[model samples]
Target: MTSLNLLLWIVLGIALQVGLFLGISFWQHWQSYSRLRQGLPEAAEALPAVDVPQKEAAGWSGFRRLKVARRVVEDSSGHICSFYLEAEDRQPLPSFKPGQFLTFRFDAPKADGSGSEQITRCYSLSDAPTPEHYRISIKRVPPAPGGIHPPGRSSNFFHDHIEVGTTLQVRAPSGHFYLEPGSSPIVLIAGGIGITPMLSMLNWCQAHQPGREVWFYYGVRNSRETAFAAHLGAIAAAHPNVHLRLCFSDPLAEDQAGKDFHHHGRVDVNLFRIELPLKPFHYYICGPTPMMETLVTALEDWGVPDSHIHFEAFGPASIKRRNAGAAIAGDAVAAPAGDITVTFAKSGKAAQWSPQSGSLLEFAESQGIAIDSGCRAGGCGTCQTTIRSGEVSYLQSPDCDPEPGSCLMCVCTPRTAVTLEA
Candidate 1:
């Protein structure tokens, strides 16, 4: 093989692969159109779309010891991995809403190496519910570019230490961001690690609501960063009603235009506008704060109603609704002229709070008071603290259902002079 011949062979191989992919895509699309022209089979009863109530999450209640039965690498970039967990006791598992998350309690080692600190974290279930196992996909949050901040502790532990047979304490799956049980059309938008829950929803739709139309848009940097590439493509090809678009913001040289990804830019409403025919679509979006805020705002600007615009935001939400119903649901905090006092009863600490000061947790941290917290977005109840008195208002709507007598310190601010059993 001469140098020129070798180059020709490589080019020919790539061309063949691209041709095969395009052929498959076109065939699947034709099959879908044929099915539509013929008409789909009637759907069965609709499942409930409501969020899982706390008490109803699992009749067993509390955390259960589950062991990792399998671990699979999801992406070529070595960033995303999935773990399949089975109850150690071999008992039956509770069913969850398609987009719910499972909470994990970790005894992470302290920085001083003196002892372990109890840390809580939440990861969304990444597959449809099964009788034997539950799966979760997680991406390792790499260290900051300049090392300004340390890498995520829980994610690192899962990647480095956790393996098949590792036992873990996991809570029942729960979250407000889930696919409602309905036959209506829906739009699923996911970015980076945010694709975890969307996977669950997509899988469930395929398994149960096979006739329903689903527009799934997943955004990644490139092919290497993409998870379940062939799997998603296969799903889309299998179901004509399920439309999948892989959007790569920065595609690699090896990535082909039609096979590797469908779009060259980020996943936004513009793509939706360009691709989808005008119709009412309930949106479920999950991604980074900037992407979430920008996409949600754009959708709203496009006349999508607040109720139709459902998004999953972990950590304190940075997005705010432009609609008049923007205020988070809760009793009005009676803050007298932006003047409020919050006291940590356990620590005998009191501090003044203002909108400029931030959330109760942040305000407390600034005042040198420490509170145990996880997810910081109110998805995990680690920051739930007993409110001895006074009212608190959530700066953003929480995905976790609020407690009757407590507040998630990470998301809420004191409305008046409040004391908490932190």
Candidate 2:
């Protein structure tokens, strides 16, 4: 029991303790590495490759011609149809963010045996993104009650003429309205055919972020008019985090509450206020003009920040503010002083532009000058025309930026006496 013996014993004990600690750390590291190795295959299969380049080129380039793969009747009444389109060359298509749209150009045959005229339209992508194909659901828009004007040229053409194997030219998917996958609770509000994009967002969230909470509120006229009922029901049943609410403004006698629809009457802020928590939630809405305007105003009044509320109006950009008159029409620019002359170079038609005409496209149409136009809110770029001379101004910045020296006639007005190659 001398000092040297004591020192030797202490050194031996310290070495043993260090060895034990290192052994435990090595075992823990081995366990984590083993678990990660086991999960590697599944993770690789679930997510896209990070190191390899994207199969389909990166960034939006231009239109790609695609062929119609198939068509499916989504509703019992045959009013709504879903078109599945695939790349004509059978190559992988570029991926898109959920809630984007596909712009299509159609050479619709004239009723007479004269010839075909070019028509353009934009439809929201209805399904989640996949490399193989894209899907768009379109509602057939019949002519007005009196049959005065012709039926919706593009929609009816798609419903009646387009078939499987038909080749169609479609621009790559593009849109400002898209879902940003995040931890924020999502509230999707859709009306009638506007549910297409919502369906895309819903399916994407369910597949990619299954744990995210989602609440979907959809409105239609009646049970018979309800499109994708079965599909929506299946989604709600599968995803426990999703809350589905359907409102029928005019439910038929057979339409039963809690079975066919969750509520009766049009969807308004009152329903949302009652059902949804007042906490921060990202709201994405798309619908008819009136419904979009009403909900946007109501949500703002409910103390929701402008940044949290996102919306897209289908067809023309005609959402007027609730109770607000000419001063604050959605996407409407004020008329410039003096009469601006708009000369169509191709048609050789000159018209004095008025504020009532709304847009240059509208002015040309009123003059009986045929100009192919689509998504008149300026998202599609279908009505982009060369401005030969003079200036034009936009009511609001277009979602799709036009090429230099050209203007989207659908949302622009003559800033001065303008000559356009239309």
Candidate 3:
């Protein structure tokens, strides 16, 4: 054969091979596209429709009027009551993130026939998210030892009067401190009634992320004050990934170490330092002011990243420290340059504001002005009051947003000459 003819034959053979390869590749690509297109309908159906109106949806955009579905007296060492609430229309409930709270509005009748008084209180959801109902566990708070203030009006009202068939007006679930479960290890710390939110997180983890490692450290006065002992015990027994540590500051004689309580002291960061791995982990804390203050400061001193530490203060949002020099998270206030006057229009009282007074609520109390408050940390809107004249700033942004013209006195400081209708 001639040299040119041989070269032409080799080039033709190469072209044919290339064409075969391209055809095979195109066939495989087309097969994949066909399979994906076939499954598109199922995938689209599984996703929630965004354009559909949510009128029949379980969650509400604003305050919803719900009826008390049931009231169960949970067996506890303290006077804790659980109320199961369902939508008055018997609609499905919206799912909430674990550790969120529901704000309630109550119009309790006054004794002196001076008309009804409006009170707002917030309670953490005590159970996992369900489509049927929401549960809240409330502890009856008695008067302080000094008898300076009255007993918890909202809690006492729930325990005394709220029953099945009663209607309650509640806002949607909202809060900043919540669990975002992942493969990362988590440590949950609770004190007293703070266990309500933690229980929600624990139950969610058990149901959704059973393999995730969870360390729950709960602290209480003693067995007599501990709530959900049997429920916690049962959970610990069933889940191997969960490590339950019960810390009783003062255990009774009948309380055993292995069975009744896991530790006999307070649940502090020091206890966590010894028990948990010194690695990147999320730490969620909720409890009394002192406990939260101690744990947050200790964790910061121990070099834990601030983003990793999440906490919520239980009552009045003020975390008091034994040593005044120590700083507490979510309580840092910017001191004003000079003395500012705060006037309570309804009470007809005025006071010189000082940063040392802590919060506007504290200053009002010092001036002998009666102002209602709950969960002083700004998570609850109980301390919300109308800011009629002046601007105020929050030490930390509130988890539950207040009304447009109002501010949370518990965490707010006056920015100018302020006038409030409280």
Q: How much lDDT does each candidate structure score?
A: 0.81, 0.81, 0.79
The candidate, 2 or 3, that scores higher on lDDT is: 2
Please provide, for model 2 over 166-276, each residue's C-alpha lDDT reduced to its tens digit, 9 standing for 90 to 100. Answer: 988888887777785455677999999999999999888877777777899999998888899999999899888799999999999999999999999998989987997
Q: Itemize residue pairs with steric clashes in candidate 2.
A: none
Instruction: State the lDDT of candidate 1 residue by residue for 71-172, as single tens digits.
Output: 999999888889999989877778888888999997888655798889899999999878789999888987799988888888888998898999999877
Choose 1 or 2, whichever is better by TM-score.
1
Worst lDDT run of 10 residues, candidate 1, spans: 36-45
Q: Which stretches of candidate 2 lie over 4 Å from their true place?
A: 1-60, 320-354
Each model's backbone clash number: 0, 0, 3
Could you give candidate 3's per-residue lDDT for residues 1-422 as a string of tens digits? 99999999999999999999999999866764554333221112221222212132245666789899898766554489899999888988888888888888888766456887887888999998888999999999898899887787789889999999999989888887678534456789999999999999888777767766789999998888888888888998898878999999999998899889999999987788788753456788999878888887787777665666777766555543333233333444555767899999999988899778878988999999988876676876778899989988776657867799898998888988999998
Q: Could you give me the TM-score of model 2 versus the true structure?
A: 0.79
The per-residue C-alpha lDDT of model 2 at residue 204 equals 83
Number of clashes found in candidate 3: 3
The alpha-carbon deviation from the true structure for residue 326 of candidate 2, after best TM-score superposition, in angstroms, is 20
- Superposed on all Cα atoms, the candidates' RMSDs to the truth, in angstroms, are 12.9, 12.2, 12.7
